[model samples]
Target: MKVSTLRMALLIMISIGGVNGCGGSGSSNTNDKSVSPTTPLAPETSQGITWEPGVFEGASNFAGRCATPRSGVDPFTGASYPDVEGSAFEEKMWMRSWTNNTYLWYDEVDDNNPADFTVASYFAQLKTNGVTPSGSAKDNFHFSQSTDEYNTLAQTGVTASYGFSWEFISSVPPRQLLVRYTEPNSPAALAGVPRGASLLRVNNVDFVNNNTQEGVDALNQALFPSQSGETAVFEFALIDGSTLNVTLTSQDIVVSPVQNVTVIDGAAGKTGYFQFNTFIRTAQSELIASFNTFIDENITELVIDLRYNGGGLLALASQLSYMVAGPNQTNNMAFETLQFNDKHPEVDPITGVEIQPTPFYQYEIDYAAGLLTNTLLPSVSLTKLYVITTGTTCSASEAVINALRGINLEVVQIGTPTCGKPYGFYPTDNCGTTYFSIQFQGVNEKGFGDYADGFIPSSSPSFEYEVPGCIVPDDFSHALGDVNEGMLFAALAHASTGACPATTLAGNAFERAAGQHKDGLSIKRPDALKSSIFLQNKILVPINAPK
Candidate 1:
């Protein structure tokens, strides 16, 4: 599954937002002020509005008060604009109040004056500045994007692209980029840009060694075009020691989140394998179809490649988990239980309803219609699951590994540590911008969600965060799902025999150098090129909210 240019642009924007931490205001007492203001406040000038120190008004008081009020109905939601003419200060106020009320770590945030910063800057510092146990940022998921962009990608999984998802083995000087995979029928695929092809240049700019700011900017623009119909010349070193240059035209492409579905005949019987990229709404049908094939083939083992899957819909994760374990093992068990801040212990702060555990969904969901169909999801009924991971495997993807383990199902992991993110939020759109604040932490049925450092593949596992599996580095030498690929091969061997194959670094010299990075053998993407914050999260739609 390849990333769309729009998705890449959004990810770059998110990267910028992360660097400029979400700004905040003076510290104040926590309170439930979720109620909408009965009467909208009269429009105020930007200069007239000032922060009242530690005091905060209800978020609703400033909600829909846009600096630039949108007049027409939202094309994505089909709802009339609730936007009212206001200053950017009003938007900042909404962010401040909303963070305090629903943010999982509300008190940890330093409240700086909203007037001191722009709306985007203010929203950036609204999260905790503390670090996790591993010394990583405590809240790495905070971000905001235009509501239109968020809705389009989340709903339809569509993006403008040349359909080349580059795997950044290294992003520094002498950077190494490879075609991780290409979308079916995309320009890259049509150009025969196979996996393992090394990216040498983009439109005459050296992709690997161009260190100048102007050159890097040119590379970013060409590599991630903002709109469809844009064209760029790419030079690639193909697998068979041949160089090829192709001019790819970016087009609007629907992402096929599930790809390479196959039933592999192995010593352990037929093993079902598929690379699941994102958990978007459209993935529901694709997943069902794949699982139905597994059922039909009577595969005894399952290998899910989530090395590039950052995540998407939480409900989709639940459904996938149910299908893996089936009704007998997960019949009445909660796939995950969401825990909110103490202020809203018994209720969800955003939905204003009693907290409920997310169950194993057994039926198909019409996400577009917001209805559950009567179609029973096909089950593999497997006792064990094989997962291929990397630092990019995150959120809903991690939830699958954790939830299955909670039910005592064996999950043999391959590759390096996963991008630990047991946290999630409801993407709340106020005015024209959607704010994604960490609202809750999800625990499995066993009440374990503390893998903030990430779930590591280890030979000797001592904690829940560590799982028994081979510590294999990704192989760029072979295409994903190919039996010769390092990760999948390790999984298949482990399935056939009860032992992991001996670790051997595969791929070319650049790949080996990437594996030898100080951070280990995992693919290293620039913060800007990392998976989109939208994808690297467990997004929730309030049960009571409009579909």
Candidate 2:
């Protein structure tokens, strides 16, 4: 009954790809040459989601803008709208449970209408039904029905209640264990694991006959034994019929959510690459460190892959943008903007005064307080850039992409369309939840590509006909199920030949889902692939959307 169960379910449901990449384009240690190739590959077949003329055409715009609640109330203050809307309930709840930090309860008892059977009533009913709402609930019952209803009811604290917990079901065949790419330098990769590898077993635990959920449960238990200083030795069977043993030492390694420094094969002796991830707290410093490493390498045609990354901490995004654009370049446009409901204007925590909402981007931040410093990170003003994208790219991610593209930097998209999560959310804490919503839209200096459902890349990358085996890179062979790594390879080839006819785009249904244009766009309707692309191509979709 604890909301953390609901949070995990929600995270899984909305987790989408958290953004990361795999594979290594042989290192080149810098020339600044550009390669514009003419690929003769056939166009990818159009996926079902075509440029169908309709309103709320894409998933993100519909989800981020239309579907989500436009307003919320401050549970504590009762001040609605502009004053205080929804709290960051999900985030806070997640952290609380994750940290085992707090115990809170909510019920559907109505203050005015006592018989309404408020949250309190819902709890009573759960007790009657023999369910305990406790922190340990996460380990036993994964939130199920309350989850389904929460999706239906955007707000968390509502009187109406339904609950779902994981129930022991009949024995089922084990599913292929899958671990996605999270960081370019993930321990999996540090141990030479590649993306797309199926984790068949952990430490010799055969999942072929065990329940898939049990396998995952076992894996997590081993990987995260305690809150801190957890270490484990894991042996994995890859889909390619190979096995690897990796010892992961847990030392509170900061999950550098953002990865930096990428290399795309460039002309003769150059590499074209780009790097931009999200704005977790340590983003700026990590990016700076990555930039240093990249400059040290000899790369030629550089690409700034900022396709689907929704915006995150403004300062972080701006810092990276400055590094690329250079110190001399003007802060071309507002880094970000926010809007408040007319009813609940936000008050400055320091000044203790009602803050005025403004449309101008500059006015939103406290520039006078030096909070909006204009210092630049190191700038590598590469002219031509191949931006890898998909529909999921959004917010601060889009800002960096648009900012560079506006300067006429050759920004060639290679994946799918990008998600339009442009509006910046000013995180507001309520009760315990962290509330954020689409408040205002953003535009580049040229005033283009703002709040658009997605950005269609100019060119598309093709997949390889001879599938690459999905084995951990260290143990990878040509024997596993056919995988189409050629798509990314084609993008790399584009840096050299300016044409990689060897690879062709995925068929039509995905074309529409990702975006109209071919280059590095993500498949919006990726779920559609479960029945089609997987059936036809036999290729697993990339675990992560293009950066």
Candidate 3:
């Protein structure tokens, strides 16, 4: 049902209740969007609800009804397929998911908008604009869909792309993307696409041909491919203003989370440095191997680079927390806690079974997910770990930081404020599009989980809606693990001194480049959709109830 229609329906109840025997002065249900046992109807207090009820057509794509179980259109691919929401079919599903599942539900959305809101129009309204993380009553973080991408990226630590992820440098027309990084042996890496390279053109099209939206549309079409083996020629400008053109075929690029691992022989000691990109199942083996090497090296301190990581699997996150804290330090403690919504019992809502507080996982979950494998996960059991971040660091990644603190470990957070997201959900797919609504917020053993606007540098005064911590900007000129790089250097210095480096304000590299940055910084918008993190890899509950 459209938000407008839903609002009208909400109002009708008041009058209808008085006319019929359903009289009640005000909504008795505290959870407004939820359907309580006594109040079958969800509540809404939007001004739009006061208008006469508009027809609940949904997005013209749903044929005026949800739960039709028909294929939806892929707006990106225009494919008549199952699971993806390119079609008009998703408006109803999207509305229903938030109405039924989100923590705030009816209190924070545009409920009175026309039932005719398109997918893009409605989605735009849902985004939290300038809203910091500390404001928990309303949710503005956008982008929710199928877990298909999440599952693949987490399970194998791979994705079907040209072996590289990118960031768009141009905000206006003729938008150009900068190659963020390439998977070591993937097609893009083989094609010699270097980090910080300017993607000037794609498949003969000028990325910013002329019109603003047109350029964006062109870049999206050429860069984002739905299937593997799709071929596209990329043109990049190298450091010397020289142009290099290379043709690449897309494939499932294995993203070993441990991008670069080494023992840094610094003034402090032999510190183990690990640059992690994503939290995938494939990370387990490499992580174990790396820690074993760390133990062999007798490393006293550790530095973890998570500047580019947007979270992945929570289980892997738990495993990593365990590895860093070890059994001796974190013995029998809650790695994190997952609390369900108010509508359900304080337990696993779907299984009707109970579960312990999310613990630090010590072993890899089986392929069938039936048994916990006997293979032991490795750990260093350090008292502290140095972590680097950018605004992109989020979700399960934040969980690692949170869980470690929960178990009495010191996590020296270096870099700028992290993307404050203590909430997570199992991606659910239905009617061709996947749905993800925030179901719970997590806390540490100290019962402190409210870091919504993000953890800022320690020097910044504690104010409303701010997370206090170290502050630093991303350093693009130096490679990640290099001790001289901005964030890493700050972390290394803090590892020994235990004092946070001064917060460095991020520069407008886009303006500096006008297309390319002289300092070799990659182009990224902190608020862009690409920067948002979706940490999956939990027990997903597929919600398909259509009424």
Candidate 4:
């Protein structure tokens, strides 16, 4: 199947709530395009343009015409300038028409006049205000960012940071934060910051007890600095009850998506374990190399750690799933099939191609070139798989579990419920802002995709939504890949004994704390606190057109 370059070429971002706080919002000077509920709609004659029912093609005529037209070559598409001077009303018109044509629940959206709102605010109100089965906002993933920043993060995985990935134990007053992990050679790792160290203060501002908005802003500014060379002093409470202070400088850090690939000898057998982070282009080579090692070592079982993995490319997920199940089981089978809104049942509304299933890709893909290579991918062909998850595990990460289970493979999940998201979209750019609105729902081979409430691990699973596993709390004291870590230990133990271990006091305490705090902690990079909604957590199409 030939994938359209316009539809396939880009990264998809997913919102993993609880970066700053579960409800704290992020903003950008260039691309802050959300509407406040209290903001009144503009008058019909505000811009001397009245609302009209129109199709997306009618809006396409106004697409390249920006209110403030940009000059020079476009960095992302490598195309010449097509922009022309236009009014903001024209931009808002484009947003309305495009959203009407593509948004999954377009019928549920209110047809407000475009003249009454700014382009950003107008685009924000284009989604449905419905709630999911779990009572969470149904269209929470609708958001936008600058086209340049979106492409840069998707392709390069580089972001400004001081290098500490934080896990929020609590996001309210008296917040409890801990170091989840650090990038190697980063300022935090170089300063000897270890996992599980509790954050105490930032530049003398009390992080735990600060309640005022001003104090919170100061803390956010210090912890999530926007530029390189910025410095901050941090105090941490170590595991041994000792306190330590460290001064660190921020820099442009490239994220390492794959880490801690180890082979563990257990009573069950040799288990191949790896901590897989994001599903970006950079992760392709690392995953291949790790799978090659596992194949050579003849490991019996596989444990994939996705506790902090938000998500990224869908093609990469397909590749990884292929490596896990191999050719015999996946041959001529669909990995996933996308169903767009009812209007475009037989064809993709975005790509204009006939609806088809995405296959279990068995060969290496040249992501930069957007072509498949002849080299075969390594696979363990295991019938049973182990996955470690958290609420942060979302989008393409959830797809991996769903796709494997669709094929009747045994998947034992360990940890809390996953962030439920089976929807995806091709990032659409108009003017300079790239909008991400849900356009399609992805289902596995069995035609099951309604998982909006998330996948839960339970002792006695009564439905397909529940899987047989232990609900273990995250173990911060022990390293992630350690044999004794809370989640991993339970997974290994369950593999050997086919039963869950007795619930411990620590696990109960963690659950109690989470219950008391409405929104449990999220694992995220320090810089992600503000714009954690734009993090990698969707299934991206390939970046190039098929040859």
What digit string (tens of lDDT, one per residue) describes model 1 on residues 430-501?
877887888888898899999986898877799999998878887888989899998999999999988888
Instruction: Please tell me which model should have the higher lDDT, number 2 or number 3.
Output: 3
In candidate 3, which residue ranges exceed 4 Å CA deviation? 1-98, 101-154, 173-176, 212-214, 240-242, 459-470, 499-547
Runs in model 1 lying further than 4 Å from the true structure: 1-48, 504-534, 543-547
Best-to-worst ranking by TM-score: 4, 1, 3, 2
lDDT for residue 342 in candidate 4, whole number 0-100:
85
Worst 10 residues of 1 by lDDT: 1-10
Q: Give the alpha carbon lDDT tens digit for every residue of 120-150 in model 4.
A: 7777778877777656667657777777767
Q: Write the per-residue lDDT of candidate 3 for residues 256-285, one digit (tens) a residue.
A: 678779998886888999888766556767
How accurate locally is residue 315 in candidate 2, as Cα lDDT from 0 to 100? 43
Better of 2 and 3 by TM-score: 3
lDDT of 2 by residue, 421-520 (tens): 4333223232322322222334455555443344544333232111111101111232111122333344555666665334343333223211122232
Clashes of each: 12, 69, 17, 2
The lDDT, on a scale of 0 to 1, for candidate 3 is 0.55
